[model samples]
Target: MGRGTAAGTVCFAVANQKGGVAKTTSSISLGVALSDLGYRVLLVDLDPQACMTFSLGLDPDQLERSVHDVLVGDAEAAEVVSATEDGPDLLPATIDLASAEALLLTRTGREYALRNALEDLLEQQAAAGTPYDFVILDCPPSLGVLTINGLTAAAEVIVPLQCETLSHRGVGQLLETIADVRKMTNRGLQVRGILPTMFDARTTHSRDVLDDVAMRYELPVLEPPIARSIRFAEAPAAGRSILRTARRTRGAQAYADHAKSLAGEREAAS
Candidate 1:
């Protein structure tokens, strides 16, 4: 309903238990779009696969520090933050993050680990007068400890749904996990909306799935669904978001408009 913290930063976790729903794409696109609008933004890569990290043009293997280090308490989040060419600062991840799950499981209050880390980062940034306006977390495609941490740290969750049959099968399960997170960890966590990605406007099946999701879940479907595009795939190779690489494309324009709408909502809410 409101921003996550009193510090005025709105943290969004783009998550879905099912993969290939454009979670990473949405995270990068949204963050970059917001940054382009002059908002200070941070994008955190919580996926062990480091797709976001690689997509932002960073070599996870070459990095000496990652979100794994921050989670393990070996490094502060500020120390791991790297400025990306995509306009937003990044908290990169590596394969080592996969082990963080077992490590965090053995630790007490593991669900709040990400929240604590981000809060500390936000405080430090605020003190420097460069506070971020938004934080976008690209959660791993699972309901594991990592995703739990991401959910716990975020104020809102954006479910990126592919408008295809069976693609939304996991939305129900994810809602259950969000409910559990609210009951146990972060009560302020809210579902922002379902974002349709890779949408085929020409297909009635796509429209059918969107309608069914809205009717069944009673959740709002964000407007101007991101149309399916090969350009989305190509942008990552250049280590940039579609907004930067394919500025004139419909998919890019959709994300830009989505970011504006979300930002405008936050402003209106405030």
Candidate 2:
């Protein structure tokens, strides 16, 4: 692990309504890349699957605290945060998160639990002087409380879509949800950009999806899409990111490029 960069808060929700679009993969890898660039990143795992939690080698079952506790008001945000060797911090989720939906139905401010929790956390961090530069929320596949909480908490949303036709259908639905969140909860929110995942130039279908999405959403598209590569799949299994697993692979380089673009520190790579 290396030192981190000091910057202002720039929170983003890595989201998409469709599953298997590499949303979590983008969140985890981008967090690692941002950390490598010296920014202190906080990854909020809102997914019930806990893949992000386990990918970092944290056994959620054994941990005394999780994001569920923080969101449910049973624990403080500080208590649930855990530092990592990858230069970012993580708010791990647990199986109990699967029940958070039904449990939150009775709560008055169910949609704002995560937002309130983060505001409370920032208040404490601000007094300390070394505040976080970004908070990346890895939202669950569904647009439920978990996803809404992330949308409400984040300043921007990054939509990750696979280069496939079916993956294109949910963009409008997610954006509509984002619009609703902005109308009621967070007006400062905006769409960061759209990222195409598992993109393979060899496939004509990939090109069609990209063209269709560009003409439709009209959001800035991240070029040099993450190519389908074995390295990206292998990196997480070892609790490592592409920068470590296949640092030289095109897929790894693509993630780094995406991070640089997000931070406005570097232009998109060719």
lDDT of each prediction vs. the true structure? 0.92, 0.83
lDDT of 2 by residue, 8-100 (tens): 577789999788888888898899888888877899999988988888878878888789999889999999899876778999999989988
After superposing candidate 1, which stretches have Cα over 4 Å from the reference?
Answer: 1-4
Candidate 2 accuracy as lDDT: 0.83
> How does each model score on TM-score?
0.98, 0.92
Tell me the tens digit of each residue's lDDT in model 1 across 1-270. 128456689999999989889999999999999999999999999999999999999999999989998998899999999999879999999999999999998999999888899999989987898888999999998999999999999989999999998776989999999999999998888898999999999889999999999889889999999999999999888988999989999999999999999789778866
How does candidate 2 fare on TM-score? 0.92
RMSD of 2: 4.2
Candidate 1 TM-score versus the reference = 0.98
